[model samples]
Target: MTTILVPYHQDERLLDDEIPVSADITVRSQVPDGDAWQRMAGVCSATAAAVSPVVAAGGIPVVLSGDCMVAGGTVAGVQRAGVNPAVVWFDAHGDVHTLQTSTSGYLGGLSLRLLNGAHPDRYADAIGLRPVPAERTVLVDARDLDPAEVEYLAVSATRRIPVSEVSADTVPSGPLVLHIDVDVIDSGEVPGLRFPVPNGPSTDAVLAACGRLFATDRVVAFDVACPWSRTDDEGQRNIRTQLLSRLAALAHPG
Candidate 1:
């Protein structure tokens, strides 16, 4: 397994960060001077370039990124390695919004939808990524959804499941790309979240769900998104560090 670190929040670089990882590769994207969407594409393309060879050589790529959108790059890299994979996306909010549907115009909100073949010109097409089918994608623990997202999921083929119930039997069949946004865990357990949702699953429950996925041995890539705000508080930083450490350990269990 190769641990890859990408220390940026969307297109912007994060400052005063303390993300704990003994990184095998740290992706530094040369974001061209452009609009927000174009810059984001630069980051994802850089990530794809970094992750492709690692997977081609038969090493599992564990990507640590600041936002969920980067998972597109991971998916592209896995495909470049010649394995078409189903996606298991775990997030606090439904990342199913498109440009027109999203009121805030946040690109991060459109992550999962883009992976399911929406807005190719903006994302998938930019990164040379082939969108994964909606039926082949599973979204877990999207307890905080917008009205637009709810309406979309009502008719979409994407399967939704609670974190506690996720396992090999429940996920889509074939190779898997497991993506977890840390905010999916209870906001109380993880401080400094930029968009915290209350009453979510505990850290232990989330880890157990991931363990079930890892136990299947079909997960080719693991994408973990750290979408939290910068915090100098020792307590907050410590909690963040411990949680990430535990999650990383799951991919390298002895």
Candidate 2:
């Protein structure tokens, strides 16, 4: 059976409702404050530990909670099983900042750098997983980028595809880990995100892209980030719910 591991804490009510089948749901509510990187790391480490056994047994796809920073632990779990997974990072921001350059100092913003070998001591050494090769990483739907992140993208070998270019033809040549940051969706669609950006991909466009990606058969696991559903805007919540349902359907199509 497949498993959807919910590794979040702040807004449990958003995902408390029933999810689709084709998954054995596992919820880990160890949410850390946005300012606490160590706490976040600990939670992710624990979540990885809990899910590692099942992954070792094989044939299960783990859908972790929507926190981009937790990518470290997910990568650790995949690496422990001896898999080199390609990454499809879907988000508005590149998330390639180091702690030193980050204006917000949000751990989520620094996740991609950790995945791609920036802060070796905190991420690579602590997690016991090497950074994924730049060639194997793909950043999609990115628009709001930091200056440092932009410089990194210009030189890095990771494939960076703008939201406008994500079509059915995009394909990864190896095992894949798909990460979606809801902020990639336009603020009009999901206004609840802490960092909502303007002029992102439409909901249907993103879902279509995800559908094509899932059809590739190379995807081994999926992770989503920053899907806040409790904002004051009811329309945004509706959009979020619809998007989640679409993702669940893609993961469990019958």
Candidate 3:
């Protein structure tokens, strides 16, 4: 059975408009307070508690919440269950910043870096999840990266498939954890993001790409980070619905 785990951020209200319609879904809210790092750890612990049983019985596909910080917790859950899953990170920015290098100091922006073993002080001992090696990680549709992040991407072995080159020959296969940051969609199409970039992939293109990738039967997890938008809530909800429907279609049949 595929278990969808929804870890809602405390500061962000749950988008209860479209969910709860699915009978197969199991929704668990994980609202955390206090420092960003601590809250992230709490979220991960909660996720592990919710998914351990399903994972122990063989393992199940998971659809996690949209806070990019939640990726750490998802990683912890998967790792604790003894699954060495490949990770496909779909985003505009690399999310590869350490505390020292990050200009914004936004914990969301640093989630990926924390997962990749960048900063020991900030995340190493706290998260209890080791970074998935660069070889096992593939980043797709990444264009708006910071300078230091670009440097890390250049040196690190993580395969990068730009939005333009997604059709290229180098895309990686699963057992994969597919992470989608909604900001990767152009601001015109997904105008609900806190940071809207001008040029990003179209919804159709992203779905098609994900469909092709998920057909590999290696995608055991899907995590989406679509931040709440004050302006276009309906539009963002529509996008999320479409994306989730596509993911459900691509998921392996029981």
Best by TM-score: 1
Per-model lDDT: 0.90, 0.69, 0.66
Q: How accurate is candidate 1 locally (lDDT)?
A: 0.90
Q: Per-residue lDDT tens digits of candidate 3, residues 170-198?
A: 55544667788767877787645677887
Task: Please list all clashing residue pairs in model 3, or write none if there are none.
Answer: 66-225
Error of 1 at 162 (Å): 0.4
Q: What order do candidates take by TM-score, descending?
A: 1, 2, 3
In Å, residue 45's CA in model 2 sits off its true spot by 1.5
1-254: candidate 1 lDDT, tens digit per residue: 58899877889876525566678888887876888778888888889898889888988888998999899999998998899999999999999999899999888999999988899998899889999999999999999999999999999999999998899999999999999999999999999898999999999999999999999999889999999887789888888889888998888886
Error of 1 at 178 (Å): 0.2
Could you tell me every candidate's TM-score relative to the true structure? 0.97, 0.83, 0.82
Tens-place lDDT digits, model 2, residues 92-207: 88988888889986767888878888887766775576788878788997799989888888998888997566544554577777788878888787756778898888877887
* Per-residue lDDT value at 58 in model 3: 64
User: RMSD in angstroms, candidate 1?
Assistant: 1.1
User: Residue 21 CA error for candidate 1 (Å)?
Assistant: 2.1
